[model samples]
Target: MSYYDEIEIEDMTFDPKLQIYHYPCPCGDRFEISIGDMRDGEGVGVCPSCSLMIQKRGEASNSSCGYLNAGYFSSTISSATRDLIKTKQARHI
Candidate 1:
């Protein structure tokens, strides 16, 4: 029921296929939160097997950068972000 700590969004890994972001938990399981939950300003990442949680810090745009940097263009990342936003909106309806 209580959170262990606040984890930076930059420290988490974004799974484009799962549409979820995850960070390692101290309990050996991962702390997970969905991109949709993040977009809605939800900051809690929870470990499925435990009651522990972590507060996610930073913006979604900044976190969802697995495909960014290097030689890849910003547009591709932006497109993916747009798609994620659309998906989030669709789920609400």
Candidate 2:
């Protein structure tokens, strides 16, 4: 079975401003990703550690199922955003 088979995704709103797909991770962690940026059929992203392409199950539209493995940090993202992720990770542990 593929790793994608293990992920449970909900219908999520796409954000044009960020150009990414968002989903709640199985670990209770939320991740945002850019499907357009990934190699075709190879769900991959540029997040710190998690970098892979993730696809939702049984979704006809790619917009509903395709996503990068993790969220990326660009000039658009504020340092505060990174800090918040760090904080969340700390709390999760």
Candidate 3:
């Protein structure tokens, strides 16, 4: 099965400073994303168990408001694959 099959997606609010996305997973794992190296529509993020690339739905908007600045305004992931991203990031770092 494709890696995508193990992941769940959703729309959510993002914070650049904290570099985290707050959401709950199907397996009861609450997680956050790192925005340090994110592009407008796609970026690498880390979770408790996994590391993965997150794709946002819409283009990034330029607004004076801090929250409206950049990153995926609405996004989500699955708990099962969440740790995969974290593992990837650890290797890079």
TM-score leader: 1
Ranking by lDDT: 1, 2, 3
lDDT of 1 at 69: 28
Q: For candidate 3, what is the lDDT?
A: 0.39
The lDDT of model 1 is 0.74
Lowest-lDDT window of 10 residues in candidate 2?
A: 60-69
- Estimate the TM-score for candidate 3: 0.36
User: What digit string (tens of lDDT, one per residue) describes model 3 on residues 1-93?
Assistant: 112122222354555546555444444554444443433333323345554333333322322123432323324445433455445445544
lDDT of 2 by residue, 13-75 (tens): 456466665665555554555544431344432233354335553331433233221343435
lDDT by residue (41-73, candidate 1, tens digit) is 889999998889999887666435634323233
Give the better candidate number (2 or 3) by lDDT: 2
Lowest-scoring 10 consecutive residues by lDDT in candidate 3? 1-10
TM-score of each: 0.67, 0.35, 0.36
Query: What is the descending TM-score order?
Result: 1, 3, 2
Please list the C-alpha lDDT of all candidates, in the order they appear.
Answer: 0.74, 0.44, 0.39
Model 1 residue pairs with clashes:
none
